[model samples]
Target chain A: MTYRIDNLQYANWSEKIFRQMREGGVDAVHVTISYHENFRETVLNFEQWNRWFEQFPDLIFHGQWGSDVRKARETGRTAIFFGFQNPSPIEDDIDLVEILHKLGARFMQLTYNNQSLLATGCYEADDSGITRMGKQVIKEMNRVGLVIDMSHSADRSTIEAAEISERPITITHANLHSWQPALRNKRDDVVRAVTENGGMMGFSMYPHHLKDKSNCTVESFCEMIARAAETFGAEHFGLGSDLCQDQPDSIVEWMRVGRWSKEIDYGEGSAAAPGFPPQPDWFKDNRDFGNIENGLRKIGFSESETAGIMGNNWLRFYDENFGPQQI
Target chain B: MTYRIDNLQYANWSEKIFRQMREGGVDAVHVTISYHENFRETVLNFEQWNRWFEQFPDLIFHGQWGSDVRKARETGRTAIFFGFQNPSPIEDDIDLVEILHKLGARFMQLTYNNQSLLATGCYEADDSGITRMGKQVIKEMNRVGLVIDMSHSADRSTIEAAEISERPITITHANLHSWQPALRNKRDDVVRAVTENGGMMGFSMYPHHLKDKSNCTVESFCEMIARAAETFGAEHFGLGSDLCQDQPDSIVEWMRVGRWSKEIDYGEGSAAAPGFPPQPDWFKDNRDFGNIENGLRKIGFSESETAGIMGNNWLRFYDENFGPQQI
Candidate 1:
């Protein structure tokens, strides 16, 4: 059965957003539960999401395993799989990898636009690559089925993480640097390495990662995916959409520079617009997922390939990777 | 002008211990503030210590710099320097290294009788050496004046840490494995490597690490120290004592196992004991430090050598190492 999954989103979650997820027929979504939150703060976020799930049972439910996507499909509700765009939730404890996994966190990035205990983020001047804790955490994450997401990690760290991870890791929300040359985007070598190792790359719809920013056409974006699929296997890519819908500019500040710096880090932005750039008109929210689906078909992906890009590939990946290794 | 400092201790901190330190003329002490606690929990431990400092300013005050040791001597109080037996206090965040230093953590063990994010403990069957995060943490610790203590770490990891650290690291407790051949003791090679790198070795009086356990003689202990001094420079050796005065057996469970294990870890202890063994009759408490002093003198040490071994050497080390590198 076909399933539509947005591999990443950090919306100002509300009943309205939950309804929009249902409206979008989004069977599953990997939601960013923590940006800079530590273990306790992130647990608080989880508790908040718990309340949302209870209040909006008809529209959403917690997704612990990949099979939950099917559960969401059967129940006509969206499955919310928890993820972290940064490793802050686990802090410095490698043991927390299993604990966070048990708490329903499925994906965690090693770094988020800075040097973390694990890896160098995309914004750091020097990319030290996977650190001592990073390597250990990667092992623990792999052991416990917490997919290593290198969305905002620096080039060398990201590549090293891909190589170091035992399981296929992911970039939950990012684009190809070859298409737009953005700092948050992955270069061809990184893309090649990730896909070569059976890892997934969820192309980002975040404006900063786009070529024309907020004005990027759906046609052009889909064309980029088509090209990416040609360069990297089509099976290894999906939509992450980094859709930070309805979040205030303050949240963006928290995202780009969470407690790490006193000065505001206008990452991938200038002083003129140090906030979330306006998302492209065709992809404003979860409800607009159809725009990319149709655009993918128009960009000449086979129907099966489009379905895979839309979500089936992710579902397959989840089926294979989102549980303790059988061995 | 000589000062007396116990380079490590995790006593059941109390007025009794403070008075005993005063009676014994201990100018300062490096106290273990955390074993398995996370940053927040460790902060709570710091808060507890803060309360102690507030309640007994005449007996003890928080020590941040080597100068504080001098201040303690002049003010007739024991300066309490904070340390962690395990890296759990920092959890997984590299940034916390600086934060912990600012909070007055002067010494941090890379590992404590098990594998940590930093290094392999002596208890582990295989020693992988200083980890990725361990290397980074060593550098950060060196930069921030947090001495890296590898007292409970495996041979390779301890040697690697000493080699990697830009500043001198330490083994704040534990005698020579050549003397006792215990799990927590350091080998001759490890000792050679540490002292060669200008690091200090604070000999432990913990019964489990002693040559004859609770029956070990002061003469034998000091003789071992003399041999260690001859082998690895008398200037690099001092007393840590590792005094756990007044602590209950339950506290031993917390020290050895913490939350990392569900079952009790009989680290350096057999199932027959599984607790803090009785102190040797000659060194039952802080007051017994004099016994060691006299013993060192009887072991054919020069007056200055004995004074240095008792504490002057550690004081000099503190002055040289307890700050950021002077560029």
Candidate 2:
């Protein structure tokens, strides 16, 4: 049976959202656990999730390996896979790569929206590629099972990570820049590097990354996927959505500024609208996942190709990458 | 120039010990910072040491590499190297091997007189060579600069660690069982395995490991080293006085029992005499290091050989083993 897996989401998690996931048949979701928190703070976030797992056993559970996705499907529940949108959770320590992996973190982005110790962010004025610590950390990450996510890293850093990492790295959430020229959207060259290296690209449904913001329809999004499929195989694509449903403006401010910046960062937006951009109506929440699936099929993707783009591809990638490297 | 280095000591550190080390011309000392503390607790211990380093800038400082020992000599101070007598600091996580090393922990015993997650301690009746985690942790430790110390581990675990580690592992503090047959002492076979595999064995000067406990003479202790030198090669031997000076009896109880056991464990002695044994007269404190030097000369070793046993051998071993492996 084809399973639905959202490779990325940062929802204001609650029973309502989890129920919506069940309604949409979301077998698994890679949820953002750490945005800019440090190691200790990230641990607190994990502890909170632990409480959630204990309380909401029927709706969702922690996912450590790819097999958990299948288990979630069998149990008619969603498997919540933890991920970090920024490497700040590890601070400057390379060893935390493995420690955080053991703590159930499956994915970590090299940078969020500014330069980090590991790599330069997409918003940085100058891209210095990967730093000295980044190379060692990449090796450590490879040794363990933590998947490197380069969603918000600069062009040079993202490409460098893709090349340096022995295993396939991922861009868990971002649209193709060629289709929508947003700072957060990855360029065609970056997409090619990721796909050619057997890595993944999860197309985002966040309004900022869409061609016409909130007005973009399912036809336009699916057509873009069709165009992307010709260049970078459909097997390499999946939905991330970058969904942040029902979250207040304050949460968006926290995600963008974190603790690193004193001044406000109007990322991908002007001072007038600094919070999270509204998601397209076609895919506003987890319940809308089926809309994209139908849109992909209508755009002339084969049945198997549409299945792969929906969630089967992510499951296959997870099976291949979500464990310690074979000795 | 010859430098004086003590391979082991766990004093209730104060200005007095620093002054005594200066008087003894001690250039470097490996100091135990943890017994059964977990990672967070160990970090607190490290923070405490950091305060000490700042307070006594002229007397002691943290030593990360062998060069720091030389620097200590040049500055007329002691380089205090950090170690753990148990693997508790990492708390079953292999990743913390590099993190603790980065935090200045150069040595970590796989076990401490009881079974740990990694290995069987000396006190365990059945010795399982090395656990699955033990092997991976050893590989990680070898990759980083953290020395795999099996000083308090079971014979099988100790020997297996020496054989498995790519780098020269060390038994930083212990005595030959053939000389004293103490519970904590290593048998001849264990010593041979270590020395044959290019590892270092620092003979313990703790009274319990001595032939006649506190009554053992300097002559007898030096004679034991002389015989060990003939068997295991003098280049592999050095001093690791398991000195626990000025620490109260309560601390000894904490070391032996920790949180693992509520029932009191006498360790090297019976319940009637459970506390730490008194040191032999000739080697009571850091200032008494010269007595061992003289005793080695009295026991018919060359001047260079005597120097090696006293500290030079450890200095050489440190120079070779204290950094990340050269690729």
Candidate 3:
């Protein structure tokens, strides 16, 4: 069975988003929950949790809390695994790791994209690896079932987290840094380590992170598939679009601030990527990548190769941690 | 028989604080819950919650949550509250007022020191009153049994929120902008509105906001307190020493960016005021004032006036909201 999972979740985890995900052809999703620093807006969708569980019985939800997401499970949703974006929330407490695991986080990324208490993000000018606390978090994440995902993590941190983790780690959703050259992308070294370590890699459908959005097309994404397959192997590649279909400006503003705790000029009234404007509303699946299935079709792969890319790879990865889903 | 509350929660609200409050002759405190966009940090004090419940078994914590806190009886933490800093977290959800009241919100401020969804903040260069959302939030806060607070709210929005609310409003923790003429202080018209609406004013101990942090002692803070009292009433005045103790550089960075979500330039590696290039910590309390209690003594008050300045005025304000202490 093909299992398409949406990887990153920041400002888009809401009731409004759940309905849209159904419309956009998402079968499963990896949800990240945290005591985020910016809690002025909605933090946990647990407010509407019952309604969501009742409405979408079949849709699988992989939750990333901290340690034991399985125990926090409500009957209807998918088994949630726990994870972390930053180790700051746990502060100085190591025992909280197990406590958080009990809360239902299955997969976690170490640093959010910069220097945190645990590890250095990919964007930092210096590639100082994981901090001592980061090492502890990794050791603890390993002790528990939380899988390591280095998506927006810095190179040094990712490699360090991968090296320290007992099981393999994942580049949950990202284009190669070699491909896009932005701080948001992962380096080739990370890609190599992931494949060698028997970890998984999920290519994201975020256009800005893809190499040259203006020149991007279905053919480009397919070429990426071939390149990633050759680099990461077919068994390790999956589809997890970091897509936000109906999210708005406030979300982008949250991203803009949450990207870094300090203030720096992010450019004029708003900032833009190479082919995208400062506005998230302006974002469209421009490269012929349609509703998840159409996106695979556009990539032009045979049935077997396509199936593995669509969901099989992620399923294998998730099964490694939480056991495979029962029909 | 005496009940007193200081309108500030920025002080860690720790066991040490409670001990200090009892020593400093304080009875209750109007603890500010939200000013920055950090919702996660505000509540769920997992480690210390029980201790707070045990100590002072009768203390009141007036938060900025937007409803009268009722869980006080269980926690011994009388949460006589209302939103003192309207962060617009109510967002578009006007119904959330009643919902949050059920969750224990009472007092609702129209805005913080800068702009929010509903109104411009006190520091903003331009003064536009209430936005449509601000009006709606004010109305809802009023309709749902929330008192209105206009501490750091913009002049225009403060007036509008005060004028619109069915109940008395508060300007909890402020200064006479006419005296110091600052971004953080309040304008005269907004002050008048608070008095007209049968509310209270809580003066702060922030230094850069005073007329010459050098030229003043507790003497300065009291002058501002007296000026506000003259304009309003002694009954409406209290102490809110927005006194932030143990607030490290991380929090200072948060406050700097909080002005407009963009950290405005203060100086070379300096952010002015709180971020003022490493001069000295506690410069606001000033060398002459010694500390909080000594500083109160410096204000040159009679015994009763000193008692009110210390915290008694806020205790009366708390009873006004949290149903005259259970005793």
Q: Higher DockQ: candidate 1 or 3?
A: 1
Judged by whole-model lDDT over C-alpha atoms, candidate 3 comes out at 0.55
lDDT of each: 0.86, 0.86, 0.55
On the 0 to 100 scale, the lDDT of residue A70 in model 1 is 91
Give the C-alpha lDDT of model 2. Answer: 0.86
True contacts kept of 3: 0.00
Per-residue lDDT over B33-125 for candidate 3, one digit per residue giving the tens place of the 0 to 100 score: 555432233344322444565655565454433133223333445443434365543433455556556545555666655444456556555
Query: lDDT tens digits, residues B1-327, model 1?
Result: 767889888888788888999999999899998887888899999999989989988999998887888899889999989999988887766789899998888889988776665677787655657655566678778877888888888899899898898888899998988889887888899999899988899999999889889999999999899999998889999999999999999999777765544345677777998889999999888888889888988889998998898889998888898788776
- Model 1: colliding residue pairs: A91-B92, A92-B91, A92-B92, A92-B93, A93-B92, A132-B132, A132-B133, A133-B133
Lowest lDDT sum, 10 consecutive residues, model 3 chain A, at A274-283
Docking class of 1: incorrect
lDDT by residue (tens digit), candidate 3, A210-280: 66653456555667777777776777877655664445755545444452222432421234531123212
Best candidate according to TM-score: 1
Model 3 DockQ vs. reference: 0.02
Best by DockQ: 1
